[model samples]
Target: MIAHVLDIFFPPLCELCREVLREGHSLCGDCAANLKRIESPFCQKCGEPFDGQIESHFSCPNCSTIELAFDFARSPLQAAGPARELIHALKYRSRFYLADEFAPFFMELLEQDERLSDLPQNTLVVPVPLHWWRQQIRQGNQANEIAKSFCQSSGLPFLPALQRIRRTETQTRLTRKQRLSNLHNAFRIREKMREKLTGATVILIDDVFTTGSTAHECARLLKKKASVERVIVLTLLRG
Candidate 1:
């Protein structure tokens, strides 16, 4: 009741549509419904949507040789339009409330994507981390906020299994090679916690899967340090 009164005074609005809403809602219903899901016949490796169904497991011709160590990857929403706007709001607007509003969309993909459906009920959720300095400036890391909220809602374990050892420029502004080079030696497994990760099947969580370099590097370190069986990457956006 008090919350509702506050909402009446302040007027909650959807980040995507700017429509006024009742208390406890972020994105309006229609805007939420309009979010696009990634369709089938996409790249097996990078999760890039293709025109039609193709036969190869290795669908990414460009990065196939690089070999994403993860078992599979998926971005529930294609990064464009409302999807793009929502992500920017979360990343720049510093409104983690959006992720709490937006997480169900990511979780809904589990029903459509077989890989996500098969994730073990007890799986560990690990969000890709930003360097401590960047996190301070940003107030919070977007991926960590999403993963933490998801864990709380789903009753899954949230793990800070990886760390950004060095600061790097934003991947958005860098070329593919530059992104890779910049991220190299940028991550390290928490030393004492290595044993805990040995047999763990990890769901590597992030906000977006742009070039996949960051997720790739994180997976690489997890593979090398922990001898983990599989590292699956999950992101909100596939571009």
Candidate 2:
């Protein structure tokens, strides 16, 4: 076949290292192994990594008194090293195909994490929306792309139920309090989309979880405005 011959002439290479892939793989095994994964002993509320032994359902001291809208948060990889490179490629460089590589890995993480096993069966996968102006500049929403790929692989439906109503300042240098204030009232569910969210569980998708200001605001809107029963946040990387 023409496709078979083309493969012989131009084999697929790793996205990061350009090493030849070993059949049906995008990233070479070595590069894949180099990705830093987020494991156990993390905060129950915010999913921050902890250094010492902690009992199940334990909240990190940082989040102990902080009230979050989502039931829990999780990420597959730490936001560093190869994971950071892949995120940057997908987010800033417009390497959209990298989403295909992230979808399965995220699913694997979801399955392995006991914290997520109890998610309501009526869950919907929703990506945090970008402001319309920001979306125009980016040419694409990486979070939606990742959510779409994840839904395709998992047979769960993807919902663009939430909209970013305000265009705020860049959150890069903002303190946690400032980030929260900046994102407050920044999200609203479309009127038509509101009905679909009633009594449904939500899995908010994003590329990274930093201070969680964005996720919190989105979840708050979904819960208070949409009457959603529960919200759980999931991202590719935890900062």
Candidate 3:
């Protein structure tokens, strides 16, 4: 009654299609029915999904040669269609609530990977840091916002475990090499937080994992500075 009347006055639109979502769904039923998650047969080292073909078993073209610093990554969905728009809205449009909306989905998504079940205790969840200057311009760090919501819901402590020391423009059109170079030495462990990270495992959260250069660099610094034991990157999508 009253709730239905309110729906007439203030309907909630689907985050992806902008259609009216019926009651509790974020995506309209049709959209939800078709949205694809990253089902397995994925690369063990990099988390890229595959069809289990021989060709699909190869190391990702971008990361084949160099050793990846982090253990592995877990992404909730394929980075396309509705997932892309949803990520962009949260990353660029400042739609922060989706961070909370996506957290449980990420938790479930990660569970499908056998490695996630044995997560070591004292594992700290950290967001890839944004430069203070750009964070000022954007009014906030999206990763931090996501990490905050994820921690509140999951009971895992969120730590400001990484700091950005430089600002780079968007990485949208950059090559993987360019992305890697641009992020070089851009992050460091804060001195006060350094002591707490020794031998702790970490889960680095970000809105998307594209070339993974940014997360790689951050994890590299974490290992070098704080002696953290393991780093697992987690994101809503792998673009």
Candidate 4:
């Protein structure tokens, strides 16, 4: 009754198109339909979509020369249009409810991946952590919220095993080399979570995968410090 009254005063509208929506939905059918899912012919190592026709699995040129700590990284949507807007709203505008809206997509993506669908007993979902200063400024971590939503829906264990020891500048304008250098020694394994990570298959969660410097650094810390068996980087969008 309260919800119905609230809906009457402030009707639910799609986040992207402002279309009227039924209760309990952040996006309307049209906006949801407009989302671009990443298709085949993508790099197997980094999940970067390819423009040309390639029948077999392959790695992108970026991944070819680089040594990544994670086994693979995958994202459901291309970071553009409505997908990018939604992420920006969630991360910068503090529209945190969008995390729940993204959870189902993450779950579906995980189910489709053979490597992720069948999890071992030692598997855990870990969000790429924000530094204490950032967390205080933001009041919450977007990655942590998305990871928690995913874990709640998928029945996976959520483990915040990594911490940002160094708060570096944003990577938006940085060159690939600058990104790599900026994130050097940026992460560390949480001491309390050290024992839980031994031989664990960690699903590292984040909002976006740009040059993958952040993911690689976090995965490296997990493997080197905690003896984690594998790291699979998962994000909502591929930038």
lDDT of each: 0.82, 0.87, 0.80, 0.90
TM-score of each: 0.91, 0.94, 0.87, 0.96
Stretches of candidate 2 above 4 Å error? 1-6
Per-residue accuracy of model 3 over 1-239 as CA lDDT, tens digit each: 99779888989887777888765446666665566788766776677877765544446665677777887887878899887887777778888777766776667765676788777788899999889988887778899988887788677888997889988868888987888888887888989989889999899999888778888898888888899999999887887
lDDT, model 3, position 230: 92
Report lDDT (Cα) of residue 12, candidate 4: 90
lDDT of 2 by residue, 69-175 (tens): 88888888899988998899888888888888888777887689876666667889999999998888887899999999999988777899998889999999999
The predictions' CA RMSDs to the true structure, in order, are 2.0, 1.6, 2.8, 1.3
User: Which is better, 2 or 3, measured by lDDT?
Assistant: 2
Superposition TM-score, candidate 1 onto the true structure: 0.91
The Cα error of candidate 2 at residue 122, in Å, is: 1.4
Model 2 scores what on Cα lDDT? 0.87
In candidate 4 the C-alpha lDDT for residue 28 amounts to: 80
Lowest summed lDDT over 10 consecutive residues: which window, candidate 2? Answer: 21-30
Model 3: which ten-residue window has the lowest total lDDT? 53-62
**CA lDDT, candidate 2, residue 50:** 74
From the highest lDDT down, the ranking of the candidates is 4, 2, 1, 3
Q: Which stretches of candidate 1 lie over 4 Å from their true place?
A: 53-58
